[model samples]
Target chain A: MGGVITGVDLLATAVFAVSGALAAAEERNDILGFILFGTITGIGGGTLRDLLLGADSVFWLYQNEYLWVCLGASLATWFLAPQFNSLQKLLLWADAVGMALFSVLGAVKAIQLGAPAVVAIGMGVMSATFGSLIRDTFLNRTPVLLAPEIYVTAAMVGAVSYTLLAFFEVVEAIALPLAILFGFGLRACAIIFDLRLPKYGDGR
Target chain B: MGGVITGVDLLATAVFAVSGALAAAEERNDILGFILFGTITGIGGGTLRDLLLGADSVFWLYQNEYLWVCLGASLATWFLAPQFNSLQKLLLWADAVGMALFSVLGAVKAIQLGAPAVVAIGMGVMSATFGSLIRDTFLNRTPVLLAPEIYVTAAMVGAVSYTLLAFFEVVEAIALPLAILFGFGLRACAIIFDLRLPKYGDGR
Candidate 1:
């Protein structure tokens, strides 16, 4: 049963790494930077998670192969970066999908750890953003999370949806798709439409 | 008994925060950035530690006063950054002292949580270096840990010393100062002499 659960986590990590590699690629970084960003984006949050849980070594530290996977993903993105440059809309689409998947997976891990709903949401955000946070930090940009952006809100929705579905014992296969759709779909729409949370005293 | 331990922890946190604020002050950043750097530098590692441990809320989150303290520290540094520039050497000396105190304190906390010696040592390193890591991240410089500098090794020795001292039934008051003195003293000496660890595969 746990094995079934862990497979989702691995998939989520791979996608998270891809997103990181893609971001670095956006800046046309060298190969070393790409892989470094990709791996950090992938492993940063989970490493913290395992360390806190006092689980045996960090998850990637034990598997070690995951490191190679991050490198491979970065290499793939390196080759793929320029190809997608012409397909501008497609790149945005890919990021949206990756965010959705990682968010749900993060919530799932938190639930597995027996955390309450609030904690599950926090973990979901961690899974989705902390790596990117590190990447932005390295790039010397104000982090996206700190910006007036729609990113974390999307992860929260995904996490909340997952938690509600689990509350009712929905089959994971069914619940996952719904959560991803809600999370990424909302995010893409927000980005595409220039939607924003209304600030206090917005003209609207 | 525990009250005294808590006092030591708070004092160390204050010292680290002061050094962090001073660093930001030296850069002459605006008020917001100073507060941001100071708070994050002071509480960042402990906040991270708490979050990773699956606690219901972050430690600082429960204590709102910590935020004000950090901000005040930042404000203080704002006035002092120029003053500190003249005493740049002394500020770094303060940082070393804070690092030494944190290494032992962090190790003690890890031990309290039943962490193994290696894990305790790692936590100590994390505690000592995490602020600098964040500072480097935000400042867009390569982190100090990546260098072959003797920074973390000094903390490691302190952590090991504290652990062994506790195992041998040494009093906290006595053991802590000894560990701190050895670590901080060594580090200070190394910095003064511009010393570094032997590079791997150096002529032995």
Candidate 2:
């Protein structure tokens, strides 16, 4: 069970790492910048969550595989940049998958650690989105999560769903997959339809 | 002994919270933005350090006094802005003092946790500047630490000085004040003389 969870975690981390490296490439940053962005983005969200949850150490520090995976993904992205024509779409899909996986993972961890439901959901959203926030800040762009998109909303919905399932004593195996699916499906639809939640605009 | 250290910590948190609130006010952000930025800036650097050092939880999260101090500072800034003509100068000095105090505190904590000197110094630098980094990112400006200012350099120098003193068996009473003095003095000079390190300009 732990091995399967770790597998999903590493997969999400690798995907986010690639997204971060691609962002660095788009910004015309150098090699060091690519690696820095990739490593930070891959672990940023989980690090914040662990810190908030009072975990002794961050996950990546204890798990060498996560760091190596991020490095490999970054190097691959850097080397393949010229041929990668659909960078934006690729980033979107990769980020969506990462968001889904991490949200479920974060919520599960927070709940197990005895956080209230609301706090657990908040952790899930933070875990899903903060890496991208850091990436955007480093690249001198507004964070996409702060945009009027269905991004964070998708994560929140999934976290709530997971929490409800757990409250009803659903097995971890069933709850986890369904949570990821719901989050990913919402995000994919948002991408396909360009969906966005309403925002407070300038008064007409 | 612990009382004095806690006092200094709370003082630094309050001062940085004021700086963050002032920034939000300058940007004409809402009340929530003022509080949010204030709380984040006050705790951001320390949070990063504790996470890196594998602390069970963030310091502010464990101590409610820190959060209350931040909130009070932000509220004071919000109400006092109209009458405060020396906001910029005030911000500079408060920030310098806060940077000095946080650098020493972060270094001390990391050292106590058995981190190497280099890692302790890095934590010091991170603690002194990361709050402002977050503040600048949110306000859509470049972080001062990223500029060729004497800012992060001051913290690094102080951290190194403190580590060497501690390693040499100097008492905390003597080492702490000297470290803070070195950091604050350098930052004050930088502010007074507009001193900055040379930039990597595209030389002709």
Candidate 3:
């Protein structure tokens, strides 16, 4: 179970790293900026999650693979961003995948760490959203979480679904995939359909 | 020693919470936003410091006093913002004091947690600045840390000062006041004189 989850986590990290690199490219930052943004975006969410959960050490500090993955993806994007058309949409979809995976993974970890159900869900949403939040803040842009989007909602659904499934005695193998699908499906739909939640003053 | 340090910590938290409330008032956000911003800004730095140092839990979560202090300050600000002309400058000085105290305290805690000197210094800077980082991020403004100020430099100097003093067997009674004075003094001078570090692209 750990092996499977670790594989998914790395994939998510890579996707978010690419998104971060692309954001840096859009800002016309140099190689150092690319690496910094990528690494932060890749690991920022999990780092916050681990910290909030009182983990002994951050995941990347304990194991170097996450750092390497972020750097590798950053370097790759530094060379590829100029040639890529439609970078924005690509970033959105990739970010959606990362968000889905991280949300479920964070919730699982929090539950294992003895967090209450609601706290686990909140951690899940935070883990899914905070990396992008950091990236956007660094770029001096409004974070996607602050925007009215299906992003955080998808993470909540993923977390809640996984928690409910676990409560029903479902195996990890079955629960993880279903939760990922539920979150990814919602986020993908949002991207495809330009879905948005109503603004507070919109009178909808 | 612990008693004195805790007093300084709570004072800083109250000051920062007021600043946070003022920031929310500037944005015309409602009561909920004021409370949320106040609470996060008040404790955000120490939370980051503990996480970076791999502490068991955040300070506010371990003890409830910090939360209450933040809440009290926020509530006060909610009722007082309109009549409190000149909030901006007041926030600046209060925040300067906060930066000073948190920087030294964070460094001390990191060293006590067995981190090396350089890492401790970095944590010190993080603890001083990250609360404002969070506040500015939420409010969609660039953070002071990235604004080419003498702010982070002051925090660094304080951390280094305290660490060296402790290394030389200086008692906390002597060291803590000196460190805080060092940081706060530098920051106050910067604010008074409109001091700034040389910008990267200034071509000077």
Off by over 4 Å in 1: A3-43, A47-204, B61-72, B84-87, B146-148, B199-204
User: Chain A TM-score of each model, in the order shown?
Assistant: 0.85, 0.93, 0.95
Candidate 1 chain A: worst-modelled 10 consecutive residues by lDDT? A85-94
Model 3 agreement with the true structure over B64-162: per-residue lDDT tens digits: 688779878988887776666776777777788888988998888888888888888888888898988888777786666675558988999889998
Clashes per model (N, Cα, C within 3 A): 1, 0, 0
By lDDT, the best candidate is 3
lDDT of each: 0.70, 0.80, 0.81
lDDT of 2 by residue, A129-177 (tens): 7788788887887666555457867887778888888899899889889
Which order, best to worst by lDDT?
Answer: 3, 2, 1
Better of 2 and 3 by lDDT: 3
Candidate 3, which CAPRI tier? incorrect
The runs of at least 3 residues in candidate 3 whose Cα sits more than 4 Å from the true structure, single-residue gaps closed, are A30-32, A79-83, A201-204, B1-43, B52-54, B59-130, B142-204
Q: Quick one: best DockQ, which candidate?
A: 3
Give lDDT tens digits, candidate 3, residues A1-204.
889888888988998999898888888899999999999999999998877877777899878999999999999999987787877777777788889999898889878877667666766777887788788878977665554456767877888888888788799999999999998998888777867654322331
Can you give the lDDT of residue A201 in candidate 2? 22
Predictions' DockQ, in order: 0.07, 0.15, 0.17
Alpha carbon lDDT at B83, candidate 3: 65
Compared with the true structure, what per-residue lDDT tens digits does model 2 show for residues B59-135?
65546687789878988887776576766677777788888989888888888888899988988888998888887
